[model samples]
Each structure stands twice: as C-alpha cells, then as structure tokens.
Target: MKYFGTDGIRGEYGGEHVNEAFFEGLGAAVSAHLQGKIKGRLPKIAIAGDTRFSSEPLKAAFCKGLRGVEVADFGVVPTPALAFGVLKEKADFGVMITASHNPYTDNGIKFFDENARKASDEAQEQIEKFFDEKISGSGAEASVKKVDMKSHYIAKMGSILPKGCLKGLKIALDCANGATAGISGEVLRGYGAEVVEIGISPDGKNINCNIGSEHPEALARLVKDSGAFIGLAHDGDGDRLVVCDENANKIAGECVMGLIAIEASRQNALKGGAIVTTIQSNVGMDESLKKRGVEVFRSGVGDRLVMRLMLEKGCEIGGENSGHYIFMDISPCGDGLAAAVKLLSTLLCLKIKVSEMSGVVSLYPSIQKALKVARKTPISETPTLSKTVEKIEREMSGNGRVLIRYSGTENKIRLLVEGKDSALNEKSMAELVKSVENDLQ
Candidate 1:
C-alpha cells in the first residue's frame, strides 16, 4: 500500500517512489517475487510505456533490476496492449509504465499476471513485502529484446469491427497525446473510416494537456466542426474512453455502457443476462437495463474490482463511470480502443446515431464533488459525517442516493448525491460537503 495506489504505483515524476532508483528497487522486488512462483527457466516479462518523458528512464532502471529474466520491450504502447503482449508472448508477467490520465509531470507502474489480468491484491502485497526488504538482484543481467507488439495489437483491434463497417463514417479521435496516439488512428482508418485526429502528437510533456478524456471540450468542438459522426477521446494510457455525439454533446459513460448492454442483449450475447459497474455509476443505467430484463451489479470504484465481480457473476462486460470499459470476451483489462470498436460495431449494426444511442438511458440529476483533506480518517469513524449521510438519505426517501468515500489514489474525499430533483440534489450536496469539511477539521 505504501507504493501502490488504486490502480498502480503513481506519483509526480522524480518523487520518492516515481524516480528511477526506487523503480530499480521495485523491479528487483518484482523479480524476486516471480522467482518464487516460476520453478525453472528465467521468467519472461513484457514491458511497455506511455508518452511521459520519465517513463523511459524508469523502465530502464526497472529492467536493470531483473536478474536473469527475458525482457520483451514494446516501446510506447498502451497499457492494454502490454497486457495483450503478455499473453501473446507467453510471458510470465507484464509491466507498464504510465500514470494513466494523470498529467505529464506524473508517472507510475502497473503489473499484470500471465492471465493478462491486473496483479491481484495478494500478488501486490507480496511484492510490497519484498520491496520493504530492499531485495537485491542476483547479479544476472536481463536479456532484452524489442518486440513489435503494436502491430499485433493493431491487427487484433482493427479486426474487431467487420471489414468496411465504417466505410462512410467520419470519426474524430483524440488520443491525449499518449499511448493510443499512433495506434488507434491506424486501426480506425483501416476499418474505412475517415479519421480526424488531434492530441496525436506527443512531445512527452504535452500528453493529457487540455486534451484527451480528462478534458474533452476540444473533441466536442472537433466533432461539431468537422461534421464527424462521433468523437472518441482516450486517456494518457489508453485504458479509458470518452465519446461525443455528432451534435458535440459528450455522452455520459453510463449511457455508453447502457447502449452496449442493450445491443448485446438484443443479440443474445450478454452473458448471464447481466453487467457490472461501479458504485459511482448512475442508477438510471440500472433502471434502463432492468427494463430490458438485464441485471446490473455494483462494485467499489476501480476497474479491477469491476472485473472481479464480472467474473464472479459470469458477466462479459463491465465499466466505470470514469470511462473504463472492460469487455471480458476480448481482454481481461479495460481497453479504450476495444470499447470504441465495440460501440462502433453496435452503432453500425443498429443503424443509429451516437446521440440516439445515448437516449437509451436517462440519467438522474446528480452532484459530485471532491474536497482535499488534511488526513484520510476512516469514514466509519467520523460520527458527524455518518449522521449527516443518514439524514440526507432519509430526506431523499428512497428516491435518491448518497455515496461518500476517500479517493484511493489521492488525499481527498469524494462525495455524490443523486435524486429526481436537480435543485434538491444540489442543496443536499452542499450540506454534505460542509459536513465532510467540518468532520475532517
């Protein structure tokens, strides 16, 4: 927990845990942990990174820590591609250097097991234990080789949609100047769509700067101005997606998920007749899916938990409101490009506009806010905050909901209030925010 966050180990570049020296030690620790798992032969690791300037140095330092391992270096690929590479190359594990949607000034690392799944909590805890012990290398150098993972990834993604499925569509794509900058454009173009691209040029420092999924105003404008059928924006590491309609309206992530679920149900392909989402997802999506006889299950925030629940429930699809969509049938991890292709395929088959698809779910009015905290006191231990939440829930009279939790990756508390009345939701959120601040103080 000291180094890992909600998704992985992330912080400002050059900070205590993000710097090269610590990465070198982390690499050694990871290697030590793997050595205990694999009995014979050197474990092979597939490593990739995003566009952050510091990623290269950190990757080198980590690679140096591996003792007698074979390294398949897939330079400048998306996080999901590195996971796919892990399976394609039959590697024992995968490592990706990225800070996901974070700014260029930050970077981090994520680990995937041979199953192409995020390292389990148990695996991460063992690695952390090794890191604390300052594990040293066995003095055997890693055999490094450059692998063409991009070509394989592109081929697989491009094949997701039927040939010529996008023959007449004009699609606007913003890659956040990150890992998907080069790859996503190619796949869409190959499918016969005319692609309008921005945020595709990465200068290392420009990634996620006023572009990408985190900031999608530019993509919306591009969709309207270019007369594009739709717009797709990806986060720095290409594990998240944000879509805009032809009218330049950003479709909510929940609506997108609902649209996909409806289509899958129509085709009798929705596994277990269910889908999984995070607690942060709007209740409207659940209502919409329920009308179509599809069940919705909620999990804690984070795609890792969502995926776990999906497996448990035998669901093939799951996502977060923040744009992480996991298609268990395609890949174990969330993949922005794969999600885009799946949605496009649905659109083409249904012959509906992106805006029309969004209309499938009507979201309830909600207000969400995040407040910086001096400390992360457990919410259960904060009596005042707990009482306020209970009071607000009672006031909503089962017509609304309240969710409050500390951010897993930052020193902040996130709060949300959802109800039928927008005005009441706003008032309740203000009161809740005030309560949180007072309790923290």
Candidate 2:
C-alpha cells in the first residue's frame, strides 16, 4: 500500500489504515534514522495538532512512538505552529498531526525539519521504506516527554513583524474554526492590528463546519459591514489562505498568491525574479508577469512539488491555485497567518486597497472541477483514464491548456482548464469534468 502520497498520509479516524499500530510503526521507522545519524545528546522532536477530534488521539499515539525526541505538545495549534515550534527549539524534526483542510473525519501527520520546513522527499522516502520493517531501534527506546508547544512558536512568529506595523490598521480574520483558532487573534494582537476575529473558538468537532476560506460569504459580509480594510480567511490547519478587500469582494485565492509573488520580486525577497507554481495556476498570472520579465516555474500539482521547484530555482515564493503558498525565504512550510501578515504588510507598504493592487495584473477566467473516485487507485494505473486525458490534451492544445491529475489529499481526480477564450474554457472544463465523473465517479 501507499504511505506517502503527494503531501502526507491521511485516512479516516479510528480506521485500519491510520490506527495506533501504523502511527507507532511510522514513528519508529523515522526515529531509527535519527538515532545513528544525529549526534545530539537527547534526540528531541516537537509535536502539534489541529482541532480535529481525531488529531488529539493521533498525536498522543505519534508522540508515544517518537520517544526520546524532546517532545513538546502544542494544543490545537495550526500546521504552521507545529513547524514553527520545531524551528524555534532547534530540534532535529517536528511532527504535526493534522489533515489540513480536510473534513473532520480525516486526520494525518505532516513532518517538518528543525528549520520549520517540510521534510525533503529523500528523507521521507527513506522513512517510508523503513515503515515496513518488523522492528526498529526507537520502538524499544525510553524517555517520553510532553511540554508546551506554543511559546516558542509565538516568539518566532513575533520576530518577523515590525514594531507597530499594524498599529492603526483595521482588519478582520476568519480562523476557519480549525487549527489556527486560538493563536490567530493573539498573533494579530502582537502586531497591534485592530483585528475582528471570527471562528476563533473550535471544539474538536467544529473544524471546517461551513466557516473557512472555502465558505467566505460570512467573512465577506462581516468585513464589508464592519468597514474593515481587509479580511483574511484560513483553512483547517492554516497552511493555505484566502482574502477579501474592504468591500468584502473576494480577491481570488489565486490572486493572493500572485500578489505575493509580485511583491516578493519587487522587494528583492524573490531571487532572479522567478516564481514557482503549478499548471493549475491561473493563466492571467503567467501572461501578466511575463511582461515584467518575471519567470513562472511550473511543477506537478501539490505544495510539496511547488516547494521543490522553489528550492531548485532558488526562488523565494511558490504555490498552487488551490491556495497552498510557500515562502521558502520565510518559513519552510506554508503558513497561512504568515502569508496574511505579509499581504497585509504589502498593503501597508504600498498604501493601496487589495483591488487596486490586483489591478496591476488581472486574472484570466479558468475552470476547475474535481470528481471523486469510488476507490483509491493511482491515476497512472488507469489506462482508460490515461487515454481520456490524452484526448483532452489533444483537443485543448494551442487554444488552451488542460491538466488532469489526482488530488494529493483526497480520493478525486481534478480537471483544470485555462485559456484566452472564456467560452472555450467553460466548454472544455464541462466536457472533461463530466467525462471524468462518468468514468471514475
């Protein structure tokens, strides 16, 4: 079976695939690698989790297996906080037990390094291979400890913002009632933004209950009615972001990534003026940025792939159309709050509304549709699917682009279309999405 997908392993809580035995096995395998290689006194690892009901239990199971790794337990923290905790303590690795934007029934673990960055594929591959072992060194090791995982993250998170940066700025934030619920308000407070927070309280069951970036109507209405300058909405684990302007009109999530990319380049934070993203990214971005000589690097669908392309290109910012944005120059893992803060800061520096800033590069119309498959089967293994994809590719060439790929986090196939013509895009999108739905759904 497959343990590592595009991002990480996720399955239903209390299910056979993600039960206690598997989690412990995974931990033991990964820890065995560090035991001999890492020359540290006490092998330490940081831990964190989201507000999913299953996350707490899974985290407990995971930490029990990663014994001897200086374990710190950050309660109901977002994915970024977990990664940040690892970076702050200067540990060998960190593990955050979260499914990240998936519904409440789903839960999984994502690992990061001491730098708060996602673990390299090579390291992850090695761990995957070892997970099949019957026995490992850390399995019988001793010394399990659990400490607070929030303070260090708060300190490091606070370090990046300038003093009084948001002193008089008015903003509204929707925490998605998930991972970043507790910390989102406090972090904004540190910057002194007059932050009006929604979805700040999460009982384990209430994670993404119609209250996230996925459902922005609530936040949008609140932002417009409150006369707020901006609005930021985060997903379950706060790894992705979405935003709105003063009028509560959404700045397309893809536009958020593009805005940051342009800003990073202008600020010299992005090296060589190259930005890495995926084919699913809006065509408008590529068209607009090319005029300015800003390079757009394309990668496979997944935050991990975008991140890899970013490093390979030595670019600071990378992301996808799905809202997953990475700032290699800032944090290793995608941090929604960090991205929000940067976008807010960019607004501060430019003194422009989000709509005004986005007008610099207009987004082209594109269509994206996902079809859920009945079972988990790698798209590469389906010959019929492959042929259908080829047919779509042939039909869309020159006039537009079509991307067919399996979603990293779900049992679904995604069809993306983008081009110069709106009618062609919608027609192709409907055709492909319908075909895929019929074939696989």
TM-score of each: 0.97, 0.91
Please give, for residues 38-107, the per-residue lDDT of candidate 2 as tens digits.
7656667777788887877777676666644556566767787777677666778878787777778888
Q: In candidate 1, how many Å is residue 259 off?
A: 1.0
Which residue pairs come into collision in candidate 2?
A: 44-70, 45-70
Model 1: per-residue Cα lDDT at residue 196: 97
With candidate 1 superimposed using the best TM-score fit, by how many Å does residue 300's alpha carbon deviate from the native? Answer: 1.2
Q: What is the lDDT of every predicted structure here?
A: 0.91, 0.76
In model 2, how large is the Cα lDDT of residue 347?
79
Q: Report the error of model 2 at residue 113, Å.
A: 2.9
List runs of model 1 lying over 4 Å from the truth: 137-139
How high a TM-score does candidate 2 get?
0.91
Runs in model 2 lying further than 4 Å from the true structure:
138-142, 375-397
